[model samples]
Target: METQIAGSIARMDGSTSQDAIFKDVLAYKEVLAHIMKTCVPEYKDCTIPQIIGYIEPNPQVGQVGLHPDETNPPKIQGMSTESTTTTEERVVYDVRFSAVAPGEDGKIGLIINIEAQSKYHPGYPLVKRAIYYCGRMLSAQYGSVFTQSHYGEIQKVYSIWICTRPPKERENTITSYTLQERHLVGHVTEPVRNYDLMNVTMICLGKPEGKHYGGLLRMLEVLFTGRYAAKEVIQILEDEYEFAHAHTMERTVSEMCNLSQGIFEEGMEKGMEKGIAQGIERGMEKGIAQGIEKGIAQGIERGMEKGIAQGIERGTNRERLQNIRSLMETTGWPAEQVMTAMKIPAADQPKYLKLLSLPQ
Candidate 1:
């Protein structure tokens, strides 16, 4: 869309939360739906109409209804499957939203939760948080009093977190977590149907090792990072008519740049290598130069002030000592006279008399 996404917020701080930008851009179902389909590969078959249901999560808000049970086995990427499952609570999400889409069969629906995290969360690691969110979303499906009362009615939950900074060890940008049915040699367990109830996907927008990325990944790269309006991306959006490509993509990207100026600059510098705009580079350089210039000038000013004070003290002391010696040799003045003329302390008269060879 040629229409510009304009907002009252023009600049963003490094520590600024991306929740506002996220809410504004993803508010469009077309954009949000496109992201859901792109980020979660398993849901590629599900149509946008089948996927998007609620925008943001609120405990105060009631669940619309139970989703269709169409959860396909999750494909874990960049990690191995766990032989066991755990019952633990997920950390509260910064941004929580839901979606509904049918599975491969086109009859069963999946419950999706989209999460956006930008800041560095140390109290809870990203992986742990991802698992927690998945568990919470899965458990939240069957509301005791509100939505689906039946145990069978529980739908598959997709917990997707778009983390700005991922774990150091994980090199890949996308990480998925899934449950697998594994049999142990020693442990006694009964054979039961293993349902992929919850799937956790962490989309890490780190600099990819490869040069090429799919349309979905490209959109996310631009959206999450501050490299405003990559020409190639805009061309792709214009070429491919996805939910986000329908004009909202351009507006959303523009709005993000116009409103949050610096969100794109932090996290990583690889964005610069990806052909960021020259103006942004110039702005950053300008800021750095200005800071350096100001510091140098202040340092010089303080040094000059100290130097002048020291010089004056040294000159005054030298003149007083020379005058004391001259008075003793020229007029053979008394100690009191020399001390008074030089404005020297009374205790220094004896030292001055001894220096001039006068009687102490």
Candidate 2:
């Protein structure tokens, strides 16, 4: 039960709602253009208006398909702000779209994917996942962007990751991994356009006062960190960056602030609950030991062990039930959802459900 509550608290701390809100803000054309102008080399010198024009009408957010079917790929259309491969191994991209890049001869198309990552180290190396996403984006372009034997027409792909919480050493850093040609033996040159098809950019954000806190990093920090109130953020966006969309930005910032506050309050409540539970458990253990000694003195030693075990079990069950009820009440979630969020086992759910249904 303690472990369950801790897990619930952790999930709430890094909740999907926060991620969704981040995605919502990032999906805006104005925000995306700012990011590309600051972080992407292709749009580094372009004006925000030009960059926004290059971006397609709508970027897909939380859509299916890292690998849509070659015969019938998902159509890139509409203005909704929100992909997967196979049915079993499908991957939904946080935000994916196509954009036009200025080239020497003509405009070139580029596929761009933007991800809002909450954790810097989520078990696996995030760079590998970014690379994999780039690969999938390139491969999924086969039937859509270019047909067989027309590999030259394949558009370049970029997977940009915005990590909200990175390790201290990697904080406020922007690293790019792209296909670069190295002369192994002789001075042979190849066109960059032919081979520079995949790129992964990792943008790790840290404290706003960090060394690298300027331009894109600072803008993202202000947006995601929830350090400033919505009005403060809006003022920064307007005065510092001259962002035009005040109302939209304000709404998004407000949503993020609200969610962050909720998570913080929930975490504090859970921490207090955990501290109280630990203290109660310690006291119960001490009392049980004293009772065992008294039982031995009273010549009831034969039943002491069984009685102690039952008492401990009952105490644990009561605590677990109380935790469940408290969570359900606080979250306004149903019993099933609360139990699922806490990661309670399916086998124990029926028993808990029965207990929960009984009168107090």
Candidate 3:
């Protein structure tokens, strides 16, 4: 039953099962608290419990924003994980919620959106997407957060992207882009709170062995990487990170690992089957072209062997080249950096570099 369920989950659309599991784990108050303290400037100095208290429970996961109508004005249209535009365009969020700022005033709150990004170079600039998300979040607040030009009531917005597989140079790093006040002439400054409403934070994660793999980086790596067993992950979270939700963590982590294994196994099986099919086809083709019984047999035997080997090799190399190109184009990484990060063989580096030099 477990295997069957895993298989079913593995077939979900575009890693949906894995993404859902990640959302389940991250939605935990304890986990959110850790992220808040480590990533959010407002909660940087707050205690874990304090941060947890500030976080509203049952954050909307995969929420969608509906277009406001006559009955439901924009002011009443609450925040959600996704929003539908007039043109039927959709913007979906992984996790979206509001958290009160840790202060005696208790008036300021943050509208936060958390995204679990599996790809680092997803065709376009991720930072720009993050900024766009921030913009959407801010604009979404027009009537819900504050109405009728009451801009002061506008809560700060944060779009935090946790990139699981980034380039080596960006591994285990957290960078934030926010509204910074730059003065060109006289040094007069407005209050930071007034203009610091939008923030985009990118947290790129690598393996746990890196020097910077400590604190939030290590914690997230352990939770999402599936490198360790569920029990071990839970133990680490509890002992090292002081996470108290042992049972929930264990269950979610275990589910994620099982689903990931299922997906991996399914992929491998498909790859092998495809390679074998190509080998058989090529073997038959060569045998027919020979037009001799003995020659046909020999041709098929050789073709089968060569085709199997070359099919898999070609597929792998093609994928590697695509990844390298994507990294270079999106991250602007030099060919050397991309090759090193991808661990391309020294002998093959020149070939790949040459291939990269050609115009796409």
Task: Estimate TM-scores for all models.
Answer: 0.50, 0.63, 0.64
Off by over 4 Å in 2: 1-16, 57-82, 86-88, 264-360
Q: Arrange candidates, best TM-score first.
A: 3, 2, 1
lDDT of 3 at 112: 86
**lDDT (CA) per prediction:** 0.56, 0.77, 0.77
Residue 293's lDDT within candidate 3 is 74
lDDT per residue, candidate 1, 141-165, as tens digits?
Answer: 5553137556666666676777665
RMSD of each: 14.3, 27.3, 27.3
Which model is ahead, 2 or 3, in terms of lDDT? 2
Candidate 3, 125-221: lDDT as tens digits: 9999888888888878877878997988888988888988789999989999988999999899898888989988898988877878899999888
* TM-score result, candidate 1: 0.50
* lDDT score for residue 281 of model 1: 86
Q: On a 0 to 100 scale, what is the lDDT of residue 308 in model 3?
A: 96
Q: 1-360, model 2: which lDDT tens digit per residue?
A: 121112111134555466667666666667788878866778877898788778874445664335332112212332222245564356777778788878876888888888999788999999999998888888787788789899998899888999987899999999999999999999999999999999899999988668878888888888887778889888888888778755545656777777766765787799999999999999999999998889777767647877999999999889989999999889999998998998889999998999999999
